[model samples]
Target: MIYENDISYEIRGAIYSVYNNIGPGLLESIYESALDYELKKLGLKTKRQVVLPFHYCGDQLGSFRLDLLVNDKVIVEVKSVAELLPVHHKQLISYLKLSNFRLGILVNFNVNNINEGIFRKVNGL
Candidate 1:
C-alpha cells in the first residue's frame, strides 16, 4: 500500500488537472468523469460509482456507491457542494471501513482550487 504523501501527490495531480481545465459549478458526475479521465491518463485503473454493500449482524443492511475507485486501492468521492462538511469526510471514512479499503480521497469541485478541497482519508480495516 502507498503512504499518505504519495497518494496525496497522485490526488494533487488529478486535482490540478481538473481545476486547471474543468473549473467548477459542474455536476458531481461531470467532475467524476473528468477525474476518471485524468487519473486514467496517469495510468491508474479507476471504477466509477462502485456499489458497496453493507452487512449488519447477519442480514444485509444496504449499499452505497462510491463516486470512484482508483487502482482498486483508493476510494474517490466527488462532491459539488458549496463547502465540504464533516459529514462528507465521515462518509468517506465509513466507505473506506466498509469496503476494507485503506485509503480514500474526498474531493469537492465547487471551489476555485480543487487542491484546497482535496482531502485524503484512511481506515486500518
Candidate 2:
C-alpha cells in the first residue's frame, strides 16, 4: 500500500467520487467545479481559484490560480485533456514549490479510468 497524508487520501477519495459520477469528455471547468463540490461534501475545506504569486529578487511577479486547495494542505490541479503531459506534472510541482506546499494532486478527468489519470506529487518528500 502506498502511504499518503490524511488530506491526500481524502482528496483522492473525493476525486474518485467526482470522476465516477461525471465520467469523462467534460471541460476542465466542469470537473473543477464538480470536484470542488464533492470535496466540500466530503467535509474537506476547499478553496478554488487560489492565487499563488511568483517572486523574483524579493519582487512580486504575476500569479497563477490553483484549481483547488484542500484543507490548505494539498493542491489539486484538475485537467480535462487528451492526456497529462510532463508539463502538467511540472506545473503542479511548480505550484507546490511556489507555495511551499508538501503535496499536490494532478487529476485528469479525460481518461476512461479515473485511477489511471490521477497523479500524486510531493515536494521535498
Candidate 3:
C-alpha cells in the first residue's frame, strides 16, 4: 500500500504546479478544478467535492464535503483567501478525524508565496 507521506509528496508537487501556472487571487473553485486536473495529469486518482457521511453516536447525522480526496488516502482542502485562518486548519483536522484519513493538505492559494500558504496536516491515524 502506498503511504500517506508518499501521496502527500506528489500532492505538494501538483499544488505547486497549479499555483505556479495560475498564480494567486483566484477563486477557490478555480483552484480546485485546476488542481484536480493537474493531479489527474500526474496519473493520480482524485475525487472532488466528495461528500463524506457524518455520524453521531452510531447514527448518521449529516455530511461534509471534502474539497479533494487524492488516491483515496490524502485529503486536499483548497482555499483562496487573503490569509489562512485558524478555522481553516481546524476544518481540515476535523475532516481528517471524521473520515479517519491519515493525512491532509490545507492549501491557501491567495498568498505571494505558495510555500508559505501550503500546510500538511497529519491525523495520527
Best prediction by TM-score: 3
Clashing pairs in 2: none
Cα deviation of 85, candidate 1, in Å: 1.2
- TM-score per candidate, chains pooled: 0.90, 0.93, 0.97
Q: Pick by lDDT: which candidate is best?
A: 3
Model 2 ranges with Cα > 4 A deviation? 1-4
Model 2 is weakest, by summed lDDT over 10 consecutive residues, at: 1-10
**How many pairs in model 2 have backbone atoms within 3 A of each other, for residues 3 or more apart or on separate chains, i.e. clashes?**
0
| Sort by TM-score, top down from the best | 3, 2, 1
Candidate 3 global TM-score: 0.97
True-vs-predicted CA distance for residue 112, candidate 2, Å: 0.9
Model 1 TM-score, all chains together: 0.90
Candidate 1, 1-125: lDDT as tens digits: 65545655776798788878978898998888898899888877789989988888967889999998887888889999998999999999999888898988888989976668888887977
The C-alpha local distance difference test score for the whole of candidate 2 amounts to 0.89
Query: Please, what is the whole-model Cα lDDT of each candidate in the order they appear?
Result: 0.85, 0.89, 0.94
RMSD of each: 1.8, 2.9, 0.8
